[model samples]
Target: MRLIAGATAALSAALTAVLLVPQPASAATQLIGNGAFTSSTTPWAAIGQTTVTAESGWMKVAVKQVVANPWDAMVAAPTTAALNPGKSYTLSFDAYSTTAFKARATVQYTATPSANQLLATDVQLTTESKRYSIPFTAATATDTAAEVTFQLGGSGGAPTVRFDNVSLLETQTTRPTALYVSPLSNPARWAGDPANDGDTAKAIAADIANEPIFEWFGGWFGDITKAVDDYVGAAQAQDKLPMLVAYNIPNRDACGGQSGGGAGDATGYHNWITEFAKAIGTRHAIVVLEPDAVAAAECVTKFGKDPEDQYRMLLDATQVLRAQAPNAWVYLDAANATWHAPDKMAPLLVKSGIANTRGFSVNVSNYFTTVDSETYSVAVNGYLSGTVGTKKYVIDTSRNGNGPYEDDTPGDNWCNPPGRKLGTPPIRQLSGAEYLFWVKVPGDSDGQCGISDEPAGTFDPDLAMALING
Candidate 1:
């Protein structure tokens, strides 16, 4: 017994050492903070004695006014990190307006002083403190210095802004190892609203299986559950994991405001989730828990009453579902890019026991562009990592082809807006997300709330084909 114990202990230690040692061939790359700005006060000494402030480990430079109009503050990386051509790297930072601001920022890498090439430029400003980043590949530039500069003058009356925590890092080696497809037809339909027709759920599942990762849909709705079961059985026959969405939102559709259905109370919601998880019974599926529930929390409160109990109910449902479906990867739905800031939402999610949950989903029902989606993803991811200390997410790439329609008219132009093309190809691994998925099927309308003419839950192949082509 002593000899056996000794051998086991020796094996465990050896395994630990092997895991800890960095691989020689793929030597772990060093992430150096070039102008990490941790130690620089008025780091833009050459340009001007611009007042730079550091708070909560973030460095901020505020440009009071660009007297000459082209004022810029630059921070450069110590060395230009070498990136293989075609390989992607993520450059990220936190930025916001001290007041309402209209300036733009650029991230550039240069080999020669005269030959600086811009990697990403003119990122627009937003009112909220946002995290922004872009993926870029290395060009032929051999310069050892990479610089981030802010062009802080806009329209003369634009607001002053601040930026901090600038970082550039190689994309993760192990990107999203999976992909999940939402099984339900649309938000209203999934919620058991009268708007759902329910024939296309199976088709959506089949289309999702064309990708390389896991596929799923909601199994909580009566019609949706039956379709998902058929799809799951078929996928099982072919040995594939079907993904699912749980939509039984209480006071769904905001009391006839927009999309609505499902459970009417806390007990009903929790019981439904529990029953749904059990009915699926060990099938390989990635379940997305409740679409638009968290994002629409405010609406729910406005339509009904206090949402504290409802949120608690969701927390209970999450725990029950996780416990029942231990073999399943369960996710929460993040409405879209614009609804909730990650930091604001992370605490709520964590308080609701999101740590036991798999991760969250984003860009569910908005037409934000891929770039904006990534920017939002980075901001949310930063909040999750920095505040909530979680690093898992999924992105919805359903109808973000042409970006958000450049109109802010107030109704729902974001829903099924026209002239949009498909954005980046859905990839497994991104900066902070676990997977990229088509949570919303393109053929279905975003309801008549927007400019789309098609009725809810109806398929428009022309729109679908345009998305495919775009």
Candidate 2:
């Protein structure tokens, strides 16, 4: 009996040493070997009608022709190890092509019947270089040899594609710190309104008054500094982090919609953004910088304005905020999932200086399910991961509880669609995003739409009541 016990103990000790001792503990670890292609493309190879070569620091793939299917011309490399079943992984790479085209990327079995894919998604490649991230859970059986592939065919013509910094890492989930629940939010003010009496006011107080929400600042506020400082001060006194929005970019809301005014020009915008950041000073704050600035840059062309000007202004704004408010976390707005695909928006984000800010925010002033917003944000991160490094993102869950409103008039879907409900209240450390914020205050009218006649930003109690009840 003693000999048998000793033998069993020795085997268990050896297994533990092999499993835990040699591998250093880390939240995330790279799973792809030779992703940088610094020296050569040893493990990476050409597939179909593509030729792969390591030039300078990139894996350059020259496609001979546009084949019938995307996978007909491809470049593939094997992962270091089999992906764990049910484990989430993020595949990020920096890529560009000689011409703009759509390609496909996949993680699949390396051997015959490679059709057992873990993730398959479209990659939008443009002339300019950009990073992309694709987060997926390994659902299929673990295959010892799996390859990460980029399909370059089926674009109607052959375009040479270049890839660098190809990285596949196990995703690590993180939570955020407690967010500040502002005492001065519009709902709190309404709860104390003179005309409000019993049950109605009580519901507003209990349901919405105590929730965390953001305060927006713009040219409408005569004194930006004082307004910002006062709000930050109130939150600081309670030992809470304040949430703010700096929405005074030049040519703001270029669509010339209801919320279409901004500072006069570049110089005016610089001065305004500088003061806004200065007001936050050394305090801890979460600022969503310019809601629609980058996403709406394309509309500026119709007015004979260069989109580059908007990108430059935003770049400067990020730099100013970084230098001025060192402790503040600024999330550049990415509009929402419905507005732009990850490919189209990623380059814009890069051009707008996404690297200078903490990350980006999605679904501001619009209703999209948190799930859809998360998928878009993650895909955007895939594009950003290779360029500016992996970035954290936040989603605006102010009023998307019931998802988007589908009406006969599709154009007015975002304009205060009736029957919309309040989404998940403001919280931090949620999966998919760093935080779920009420960036757009609920109950605010979307410019004389749906059940309200008030202009945008005007607080309507009826709208507020309906949101709470929903």
Candidate 3:
């Protein structure tokens, strides 16, 4: 068995190799040899006498039951993460069916299909041409099979399905700005009398169109399980995925004071996240796991905290959270560029179980520009680099238009900078981020900034105004 704990030295060496050897500009590529079916169905095959035609830029399928045959399909070898293994990959294809009929899409272990070979057969398609990708853990990394296919049969009559851009892609890991991501989040508090310290809207503004939000479930709170369940339920009620910031590491915010400490210790955090995962249970959520946990952990010694124990929490947290929230997209927290260097942070990240999670998040509650965050992410991913390296990032762009404050004195600038404006609004797609989010509540207090009397976590109208208008 390849135990991750025992392989720390190897991971460190691999990380060193990643940094020393210059890598490529990108690692993502189309998994399908001929997904477009542009000129020929070279990689695809006609299943059980089914007919498939590769036309202009798409593939046309016609399947009919001849005798006792149940279904017919167009199958192709499936490389799970397509270009990269274990890269939060998703299956995507544009399809237009002639009639509103039920169609089956599945991953088979081999061209000669078997029951155990069937990976997923739950997706159903309609007549309209729409882009599709399952949000749940319908396709896992091990779902890699000999052939995945689209089937049209076992119906009243013959069915015709036309498909285009059929391919496997690393979910959330797109080139600079090529792929348009479709994952969603954001919630302006859906519980009882909560502080809108950073929330500009009183009621989450139902009239306003949808936008993604990321909430960090940090520090030690009451009933970890119940709290997360409520968060997940609330987000789903509003038709949004909860971007849960899993920020309860024991030595969290090691470099900052506004938010430090976790659920007592590593064992306490493991217990907390275990219950937190139990609460999440199959919810369609986006977990931005442990902001400042790893980056700041670099300073554990300064605070009399154990860095090894903190790393243990990160490793346990990733495995537990993902296993529990099967549908949730989990990202490890990598503080903004203003915080740690990529080389310094990369080893810490890999050591803290970055490879186990979906990717990482940067600029969370910090005043770095989106461009800077992207650049930082590219460098970090490079440090964890490989042709199929499975590391992606999310940027918190709630407020950064004016960039970071020009603080040189005590340099406590990040806490409510003087003239920072709102950064890019949360959207379904951002240039490099899996989801550009309003991670930190835009108007939240950054621990008084040495100027305002507003207590930490209290609503500050002035701070809100500055972010909204400055």
178-234: candidate 2 lDDT, tens digit per residue: 456776787788788868867877887787787878998999977676577667655
Lowest summed lDDT window (length 10), candidate 1: 1-10
Sorted on TM-score, highest at the top, how do the candidates line up? 2, 3, 1
TM-scores for all candidates: the values are 0.53, 0.62, 0.57
**What local lDDT score does residue 97 receive in model 3, on the 0 to 100 scale?**
77
Q: Which stretches of candidate 1 lie over 4 Å from their true place?
A: 1-227, 386-388
Residue pairs that clash (backbone atoms under 3 angstroms), model 2:
131-383, 132-382, 132-383, 133-382, 133-383, 175-429, 176-429
Name the lDDT of candidate 3. 0.60
The lowest-lDDT stretch of 10 consecutive residues in candidate 2 is 1-10
Candidate 3 C-alpha lDDT tens digits along 1-470: 00000000111221110112112233344456676777887767777746778877878877654323345444444553323233343455677777766666765445245543334554456676655443223233443454567766665666677887665543333222211111222223321235543254442332111344555565545545445654554444334456676777765666666665567777878887877775666545677887777766667788786787788889888889777667667888887774667888888888788877878888877776666677788888888885327576888877767766664553566666677787777654524676677777655566756445564545455666666677
Q: Evaluated with TM-score, which candidate comes out highest?
A: 2
Which residue pairs clash within candidate 3?
Answer: 185-213, 186-213, 198-443, 198-444, 246-290
RMSD of each: 25.2, 24.3, 15.4
Off by over 4 Å in 2: 1-176
